[model samples]
Target: MDRRHKPSNILPPGEKLPAATVDIDEKRQTVSATLPNGDTVEVLLYGATVTSWKNGGGKTENVWVSEKAIWDGSKPVRGGIPIVFPNFGPPIKDHATSALPQHGFARNVRWEFLGSEKSESGTSSVKLDFGLYSSALPAKFREAWPLDFGLVYSVTLSEEGLRTIMTVRNEGSSAFEFQFLLHTYLRVNDISQTTINGLGSETYIDKVLNATKHEQTTPSLSITGEVDRAYIGVKQDTTSVLEGGSPRFDVIRDNLSDTVVWNPWIEKAKGMGDFAPQDGYKNMLCVEVGAIDGWQKLEGGDAWEGGQLIKSLL
Candidate 1:
C-alpha cells in the first residue's frame, strides 16, 4: 500500500525537481510518506535509505569513496541513503590530489530547497536542508578538488522514522580530510527471515579482500549470501536488529564506531534497473552506520555532522 511517483513536470534522469509529496503523522501510526518518486515511497515508518548500501550495489546510487575508506553509493542515486565524508572508505590522496568523483560530490549534485521544518519534539516531522556551497562547484568541480565545502542534508519524515541528518562543513583554508558512511538500504520481509543483532563482540574490516584483513569473532546472526564486512573498533550503546517474518527493524547507532552488513542476495539485483520489486533482494537488509578510524578532519571554521535515525519496532 506504499508506492508513489505520479507527479511529474519534467526532471527525471538524475533528477533535480518535479517529484514532490512528503507527509508524516505521529498519533498512533498509519501515516508516512517520502515521495520524491525516483523512488522513496510511502516509507511506512523509517525506511530511510532505499539503496546505496555502499559497493554491494556498486554505482547504483554512486557515493562510495576510496582515498582511504567510508563511501558507498556508486552512480545513479538509486536509493535514499548516502552520506560519506572526510574519509570513510579509501581516499587520502597524498593529503589531497586524487579526485575522479570517488564519492565526494555531495551525492552527485543537485540539492537546494531548504524549506520544511518541525521536529525537535514537535512531532509530525519534515525538515529539508541541502547545500553544497563554495560558489556551487561544477567546473569539473573546481579543477578537481580544491577544498571549501558544505553539505547539509536533513530529511525528516516522522511517525518515528526516516530521520536522516548529515552536516559537513570545512569551508576552506587548511585542515580537511574525509571519511564517513550511512549507506543504508533496508526493506525486508524475507531475506532468510533476516537476523542481525548488534555485532556480537565487534571488530571488522574485510571489504571482501584486504584492509589489514580481520573478521572471525562471531556469535549468531544471519543474512543470506555475498555479504561484505566492515565492523571495526565498535563499542557504545550499539544495537542492531533486522529480524523478519513480522516487520522488524531496530538499527540504532550513535557516534558509530563502524558496522556494515550487506546482501548481494540475488545476482546483485539483476544488474540493477531502478531496482524495481525485482525480487527486491528476497526482501532487503543493509545495516550500515560507520565511521572510519580518525580521518574526519575539518579545520577551516570547522563543521562536521552525522546522520541516520530510523524507527519502526513493529
Candidate 2:
C-alpha cells in the first residue's frame, strides 16, 4: 500500500467510526473497503473485479460471488461485478477491433493501485482508485492495438450504496471506440421472486430471439428462462427489487444508457465451467448497467465516465 494513500478516519479498538479503511486482504492481492455505516465492498487486483458487498445495517449480503469462481489468476471471476471494457464480447474485426477477449481484458488483467480516499456529507463514503495504462500492458497487447489509453477505476462505498465508476481517457492522438458493461451478478433468495423495474416500454434486442428489437411488454420483469437482452436508450434510472428475501437490493445507476438483463437458467447454468453449484443460476440475477449495443467513440484527449450505485433496502 502507498503511504500517501492512507485512509482519513482511524478508530481505536472497541471504538466505531463512520470512516473507511483500505487494506490488502488476507488473500494477498485483494483490496477491501469497509465503511463505518456497515457498508462493505471488496475487489481483486486482478481484473479489478468487485467480489462482495455486504450491508452491515441489515447484516445482509447483496453480492452473489460464485463459489466455484476461479481465483488462480488464470481467468475472469465468474460472478460479482466484472468490468467490461473496449469490447463487450468477442472482437468484431480482429485487428480492427479492440483485440477483444470475451469482455476485453479489463476484468481479466491486473491493475495498479493508485490510492484510497474518504469523504463525508451527511453520510460518509470511502473510495479506492486504480489505474490501467497501455504502457503497463503486455507487449503483444500493445502491438495488436497500438493505441495508447488510460483508465481510472473508482470504487466508492457509503451508507447510501456502493458505486463503481470507470473513466477512460484517450492518451493517443487517434480516436477509438469501445463497448462497456458492469457484469453485475446480484444475489437473490429466489430468481422467480425477483423483479427488475424501470424499463417499462424501453426497446431491447433479445439475443435469444434472433436479435430483434422489441419494447418491454410489462413494467416489471420476472425471469423464468435464459435472458440475454441489451435494452437500449435507458433514459431514466432503474430500480430492481428482490421480494424473495429480506433487505432487498436497490440497484441504481447514472449515465448508463443500456440495461442488460440476463439469467442462465438450469440448462445454461450446468454448461458453464466457472459457475459453481450447477444450480446456482436460480439464486442470482444479472441486471447489468452498461453502454452496450452501441460503441462509445473517444477522440484524442477526450474522456468518458459512468457508474452504478447499489444499496440495500429493508
Candidate 3:
C-alpha cells in the first residue's frame, strides 16, 4: 500500500486489508490496487467511471456497475459502475428527471474505502461502501424529481472475484419509482469461445424495443452484436453461469429477479474513445444483474436490496 493512502481495517477479524491500496497511475490514467491476499483489481477511469476489476491471470475486467441505473454519463467514455436510479432506460421527463446525472453520480464521484471482512462463506474480502442522498446533491438535483433517498453500494473483493451488493433505502415520503443493476463487464479469453450456462430455461426482457417481453422461452443466449437486454421476473432458484469453459464463472444473486447481458462488440466499442483496445471485445462481456421492467416503487419507510456473487471455478 502507498504510504500516503489511509489505512483502515474495514474487514472483520481473520481477514486483514492489504496495506497496498488504490493509487492513480497518473501516467497511465489507471487506478490500481493490491488486495490483502496479493491480488490486484485495476480501473481505467476514462469513459467507464468505476474500477475495471482484473484478477491475476486477467480473465474478465470490463463490467458495468449499476445502482440507481442509467446509461448517460460523460459520453464517449462509458464503462465502470453507473449508478442508475429512479428509472432505467431513456429519461422520463416527469417521473425521474432527477435521476438524470446519467448513470447517476456514483460512478462520477469517488467512493470511500470503509473496511474489509470475511463473509458468511469465510472468504477474505474488502468491503467498500458508498452512499448518496438528496442532501449530498447540488441545487439542480434538488429542483428535479425531488426525493429523499440514500444508496449504499458495497463492493467486496474476494479471493475468487468481486461480490457487489447495493441497498436502496427510501428516506422520504411519497412512494417513488426506480431501477437497479450491477452492470458487470466480465473478462474472457475469447468471446466466440464463451457460452454462459444456467440460463437455459429462463426468460429475458428484450431492451432493443420498448415492448416489455422476454425471449428466453427457450432459455439460452449467444452473444452476437450489442447485447443490450434485460431479463426479468426470474425466480431466486436460478443460477447464471458465464464461461468459455475451463476458466468459468458462475453468478448467483439473492433477492434479485432480473439479469442483463450485454457487450458493445466491435462497432459500439469503436464509438467510445476511452474504450481503447476496441478490439478487446474478445476479452470482455457485460452480464448485468438487475431489477428493471416496471419501476420499483418504495415507500418512505421501505428499503430494497440485491447482490451479485461471482465465483470462479478455474
Candidates in order, TM-scores: namely 0.31, 0.90, 0.75
- lDDT string for model 2 (1-314, tens) is 22222223422244334567678865668898777666678888888988888886537778788889987678999998989987886777644454556787788788988889776344567788889999988776677667889999988877767878888999989998888899998888888887777788889999889989999989887888999888898866756675754337776766678888889998888899888888898888888988876689999999888778777775
In model 2, what lDDT does residue 299 have?
Answer: 98
What's the CA RMSD for each of the models?
17.1, 5.4, 7.2
lDDT of each: 0.53, 0.79, 0.59
Please report the TM-score between candidate 3 and the true structure.
0.75
Report lDDT (Cα) of residue 210, candidate 3.
57
Residue 250 of candidate 2: its Cα lDDT?
A: 71
lDDT for residue 28 in candidate 1, whole number 0-100: 21
Residue lDDT tens for model 1, 1-314: 11121112122244233334444434421123343323232221122223322121121222221122112323434444655554455455655635535545555544454445433322333455555565776677556777778776655544444556667788777887777777766655677877776677677766656555665566546766767777776564444555553436565565556777776656776766556555666666667776666666679978766655665555
Error of 3 at 257 (Å): 1.0
Q: How many backbone clashes does candidate 3 have?
A: 29
- Candidates arranged by lDDT, highest first: 2, 3, 1
Q: Considering every candidate listed, which one attains the maximal TM-score?
A: 2
What does candidate 1 score in Cα RMSD to the true structure? 17.1
